[model samples]
Target: MAGIQDGMTVMVGGFLGTGTPEILIDALVEKGVKHLTVIANDGGLPASVTGTTDRGVAKLLSAGMIDHIIASHVGMNPIIGKGMNDGTLKCTLVPQGSLAEKIRAAGAGLGGVLTPTGVGTIIADGKETLTIEGKEYLLELPLHADYALCRASICDKFGNFSCYKATKNFNHVMAMAADTVILGAEKVVEIGEVDVDTFTTAGVYVNYIVGGEQPWQI
Candidate 1:
């Protein structure tokens, strides 16, 4: 894949550190891609007590590569809070389900998603509200990205993918919502090797495939 430019909105598939593409993220860090707007489920885990960092979005955050983040949670990574407090980074918190639906809506070419998830809280502020029948719902805009970095436990030469356990968290939806989708696969195999029943994401949604470091090793 080509290098990522500054100011691009990127969706990184993960739930905390579970499904993040660590190898691809390492590549991004090595390439020094800056001014990125990252979208993920969580901010990622902080550096370990031994001073070695080996988890999710925190690696990008530690390198000062991301300019903004749109995620469901940010409490686990202290770097995120520090960056936000120092005004070096901007953060937007959306309800988890709402965030997922927003991305799905974008992929499906919907105008927006109407949900009551944020009805009477700060989440409703600055957003449109519509009353259907007798209940009110907030209009959450669709969310898309210039690129999506996702993890797959198994990827074919043609880019079809399947993940194990929790690794499937946001990878499937993110692959559909991005203009360019890159898959970091723990094991790359022939197209027919992956069982059709196990295929969670189709090759049509993928643009590139890279060998990935195992999540457990990270």
Candidate 2:
């Protein structure tokens, strides 16, 4: 079915909006794909904040399906934090900006990038440092995935995707980095429905499209 499987690395798009695909997330849950490694921000939040308890891929985290996560933060999800403390969830937190650049580099087929976000912090603990000009920059490696789970505001039948406002976070670079890209959207339209200027991810990057469920009330 060209679906997700065990031991696969997945990049989930969204900071809080544009990158989440509610439909795809549900499908993954229905399929019960296990032993997964996810890369993104905010695995999911509690139902109080997000109207749908299933919001933000929290379902997977809660079901004990995932094995590892590489993200900027876990958001307001208490369940995932508990899983971490209990040794059920393994996590690696990265700087938000560095995470974005690393994914972009992967999509661009670059080895990695040099950034100054963690020059003297714990983020640099095991990383290499280089002096560029007069400043030191930490080298963060490129990060990609076997599959990418992302949300678009709208997607044409031809697979063109558009993100609205802050929702556009991470989807663009994530689309490029994954071997397979799945999209969930609030609306689906024809190829010409959206202006080319506003299209953040091109049709070429998408492999599947599903209509997203209404967001949880967070």
Candidate 3:
């Protein structure tokens, strides 16, 4: 949190608002950092759905903190659509599978990946293509961020992270795709309390931890 500055690339872990790290997000809002390029699963719930307190990435959008977002889905938030129309924001929509693979490639230190997900469609526009055995594939590059904001249902002092149920979606993959990862854990347990097999994200990837976040709310 100390090193966060305006105009950095940030990856947030969430599906809509369900698995988002509220504490860290709220802090970012209070920090008033702007010109952020965020990468997430989708645009989060709007104020209409979540009432006065915007949920997940929507909070940042509401605060006009995000300048560009690279996500697979943006239809859920009107702010994103309106911004896209008004030229106030930039949105890069990649196919979900291809997006995940790109992040994975960055984390794994790979150059790039070839995928047919966007072949023969508008998604293939202005992109490199390769023909392998008469089938076309787009060469999707890796995605990396300056900081990744992640949430975990449980985290040990050493930073092993585990999520509860569906909340586990993007947090695991996002943990490894950034230069620094900030973890917000609902509960912080003793080092031996959580079994290693239960960890969704290993401790090595986490650089910072904010413990004792309130439990999930509707």
* Best-matching candidate per lDDT: 3
**Local accuracy of candidate 1 as per-residue lDDT tens digits, 1-218:** 36579999999998877888888888898888889999999888777521567478888888898999999999888788889899999999999999999998888899999999999999999999999999999999999999999999988899888889988898999999999999999999987775777677788999999985585653
Going through the candidates in the order shown, the clash numbers are 0, 9, 0
- Most accurate candidate by TM-score: 3
State the lDDT at 59 in candidate 1: 84
TM-score attained by model 3 = 0.95
**Stretches of candidate 1 exceeding 4 Å from the true structure:** 49-51
What would the TM-scores of all predictions be? Answer: 0.95, 0.92, 0.95
lDDT for 20 in candidate 1 is 85
Candidate 1: C-alpha RMSD to true structure equals: 1.6
Question: How do all the candidates rank in terms of lDDT, highest first?
Answer: 3, 1, 2
Kindly report which residue stretches of model 3 are placed more than 4 angstroms away from their true locations once superposed.
Answer: none
Residue 177 displacement in candidate 3 (angstroms): 0.7
lDDT score, candidate 3, position 173: 80
Q: Model 2, which residues run further than 4 Å from truth?
A: 212-218
Per-residue accuracy of model 3 over 19-51 as CA lDDT, tens digit each:
789899999999999999999988888978776
